[model samples]
Target chain A: MSRQALAELFSRCRAENRAALLPYMTAGLPDPEGSVRLFVAMAEAGADGFEVGIPYADPLMDGPVIQAAGDRALAAGSGVEVALDILEQVVAETGRPSVVMTYVNPVLRMGPEVFAQRLSQAGASGAIIADLPVDEALPFASALDRHGMGLVLFVAPTTTEARLENVVQASPPFVYGVAELGVTGERDMASSHIGSLVARVRKHSEVPVVAGVGIATPDQARSAAAAADGVIVGSALVRRVMEADTVDAAEDALRVAVGELADAIRRD
Target chain B: MRLDRPDNQGRFAEYGGQFAPETLMPALEELETEFAKAWDDPGFHNELNKLLADFVGRPTPVYRAERLSDQLGIDLYLKREDLAHTGAHKINNTMGQALLTKRMGKNRVIAETGAGQHGVATATACALLGQECVVYMGEKDIERQALNVQRMRMLGTEVRPVTSGAGTLKDAVSAAMRDWVATVDTTHYIIGSVVGPHPFPWMVRELQKVIGEELQEQMDGSQRPHPDVIVACVGGGSNAMGIFYPYVGSDVRLVGVEAAGYGLETGEHGASLVAGSPGVIHGSMTYLLQDVQGQILEAHSISAGLDYPGVGPEHAYFKDRQLVEYTSITDEEAVEAVNLLASVEGIIPALETAHALAWIAKEADSLRGQTVALNLSGRGDKDVQQIIDLVDADE
Candidate 1:
């Protein structure tokens, strides 16, 4: 259901002549109920899709802000099951395709087939395993295929030509192009070189190319969406949600913030 | 006996794959290619052997521990890795990797440290080769191994302290890996174990295999026939791999002793092989001390070196194949073994090595007719301060 829902989403956005605006959230962060509230507001504010994060003990690719959020989520006892639950709630309420962003260990522990089955049952459109390298993504990729779900793979500026081709070929639903060379953090703008990377990805992939990691502002999202099919905003909205004092405050801040980002993404 | 492993994908049985981010995959592939080429080149081996003999004082003497043997009613031989320069077998891997770094045209090196032995050794290698070195050590380890921290800095290497995840060896490894991911083009990550992704586990083992090679030749020359048993302590299991590689298919029995901390039954131990389930940590799938939810549990041990939650993937393979007997020793038992070795043989072993000594002591009476070989992996000078505190408290 989510596989076709995700494809329909991209096509619908394409027909509307605007790029999709995807927002990311670390599940159970700040507080469980607060995270749910924030996600609901993001959906209402015009997020085209969602990428719900599952916290791990060690998140090597995340910067200080996201790492702190993950710490908070883990402290709240929001294990993998809770993250899945949050994804289900987000998809149910919003009726938009959602993906779970997680590291590979948790997926490996749950057994790929079981994890895939549960995520598909929960209505997740796809998953982005931040650390599952191309060489090791095969078994999990196959499992996701059986459940008719997507496995979003990453391509960086430093990714070699041969490896980039492999990533483009293997990835489904969309290709997540890292906007900069560093780990995920809130930067003033995306890397200027992302246009060339998106072009390189475009040569091999017909699926939408979604740029992420370091896209922080409306201007950055606008510029990023100009070169790619869409933009996935993570740290920017997450940072706002993190700074808000309460659930209501977080939802309010996220509502206004997501509206700006969504409007900006539609410009190109 | 000849040893072969890591079938093309760098896996030892079901363990050991490159489970890294996409950005790091190319670098790992590059390393794998370089290592394979270098290992085949005679020139590389020539340079490495030269350093091992002249600089590291390789072919370290194997001495008969007659006094301890008499006390235990067994014939015991100790491979004197304690006499190696920088005071442990760690230099062997560092030296080899430093040479590889130069060959790869990488002028900068980064490493993760636990007990600080690998750090001191890596710093020494970089200083010798004129390569810029950075070592990440757990904050708690930097506190416990103060002398080694000073030694690393004094050798002109930058020591970065890691404050994540129980502040121990596992955290240090995670930090080093993150650094490598961002700086992969100019830096060679000198992983200080036989437990990391691909090429590293195989590379470190091949470099450290000199220990088992020399042991084989030395034992052949000695009056005592082939030893019935061999033992070494395992943290990331480098030294054990070093001594066990050359004897893979032989008749000799091999044992790896892990730090049990308080006790394995109490669940405050680093004996992953004995008490852990299979899980991935630090890029390789291996036996890990993880909870039911797959969250890696912090390990505990008096020995900073062996206080880790994971073991080398090859060791896991060995354990499954029944090729190696994996066991554990508690902190109290290891400390007692340290005192016994000092009093009987006048050689103070590092707390890590004392774990193996404790195992030997326990099984000595049963193997009275057979000869046992143990790798005294390091000298206890670096550990003297910590041991002194423990002893004084006991008094």
Candidate 2:
């Protein structure tokens, strides 16, 4: 049911001939309740969907912006339960397809079936487990499948054609294309290699491919969006929320920041 | 190879799978292929063995601890890895990996260090091999292990201090992973222990298996051959794995000692094998010190090298299969063993090595009349300052 909602949103974006603007936020950032408000504001600001990050002590894939946010959220007692609460609220209030981004350990710690059941219960569309590659995702993907949820897999420019075919065969909710060879952070421009990687993904399946990592500015988002079906702007937006002194300040900034990104990727 | 691999996907009986990000999967696969090819190649063997002999001082003597052994009514033999070029067993792995890096056509090297022994060894290899090298060390370790830190820098390597998450070994591992993700094209991360994602645990053990191979050759023909038990300290467990690999299926007992810090009771210990549950850390499934919510807890030890929250996945496999015995030694006991070794044997040992000695001392009663071999993984010079500070505190 949750994956169906995300599929419909993707179809709508495709019909409009525009890339969907999917913004990411670390759950329980300032606090649990405040993060729900932040997601609500982002949805109101025209984000097509949300990717809520679960706080983990060790985020090897994240840069400073998201790392600091995760550390703060964890310190604020944002464990899986708290993040799920925030995910449930964001999905209920925003009425958009949302997912959780986490490392592999927490899911394994909770046991995949239980974790997936709780994620679905929280109204999540799917999950993007950063360290969980397709090769080691059998149990997790099957567990998520039982809950009618999708497992999103990543494809980097470094990924070979044969491996990309294998990833597409997993039939993820959507394919996450890593924009560059680095952790999640803002870059001056969209990575040049993303276009080829998106093209590779397009050849295998009709599944929507989203470009993420280091996409900060409107033009960068537009370029990344051009290469794929959607663009995921995380660190750029996360940096705003991180630097804001108050939730009110962050909400207003996100409204404007997400608006510019939406406008840049939106078709008439 | 006496040390078996973790299947095709790198899972060693539910432990030691490649749980890294998607980007690193190809690199891991590539490394696995390269490592196998290198291992099979006679040229690679000749070069590695030659360097092991000429530069790093191969076949470090296995000396009998006559005085200490007589005190306990047991024969204690020490595999003096301390006598190696870098003053630790770490060189055995680094020299091999640095050469492997060159063969892979990667000119840059990155590594993470705990007590700085691995960093010094890695840096020395990169310097000798003419590769650009960088090492991430915990800020806490850099403070505690100042001398080895200086040696690493003097070897012309960049020493980056990781201040995140207690600024210890695990955090340093995370920092090194972050760097490798971006620089993987031209660089190779020389993980310092039998940890991390696959090819690493298997490959490091293979490189270090030389210790066991040498021991078998030296002792198998002698009258005083076939020890009743073998003991070594385990952090990420390379040194222990090194000396324990050959005698795995034999009747001889294999024991790995961990640091108990203040004591397991105080919850300030690094005894992951005994105290931790199965979980993933540094990209592989292993026994880890974590809260129920899955947040990693800080591991404490007087020895900087053993101050880690996780043990090697291979060690986890061994523990589960009952192929080896896992034990712990407290900080107080380790200190006492250090004093005992210095007084009785005139051989100052690394704090990491003291854990194994302390275990022997504790089990002296049971081990009486039995012959035991312990891998003295490193010398005490790097830890002498810390020991001196402790003595001064007592004074």
Badly placed stretches (over 4 Å) of model 2 are: B1-3, B221-223
DockQ of candidate 2 compared with the true complex: 0.81
Model 2 chain A, poorest ten-residue lDDT window?
A: A186-195
Q: State which docking tier applies to candidate 1.
A: medium
Deviation from native of the Cα of residue A179 in model 1, angstroms: 2.4
| Cα lDDT computed for each candidate against the true fold | 0.88, 0.91
Interface Cα RMSD of candidate 1: 1.3
Question: What does candidate 1's lDDT look like per residue over A130-177, in tens digits?
Answer: 888778889988898889998888888778889888887786778888
> Residue B43 in candidate 2 has what lDDT?
100
The docking category that best describes candidate 2 is high
Ten-residue stretch with the least lDDT total in model 2 chain B:
B1-10
Q: Could you tell me the TM-score of chain B in model 1?
A: 0.98
> How high a TM-score does candidate 1 get?
0.96
Question: TM-score (0 to 1) of chain B, per candidate?
Answer: 0.98, 0.98
TM-scores, in order shown?
Answer: 0.96, 0.98
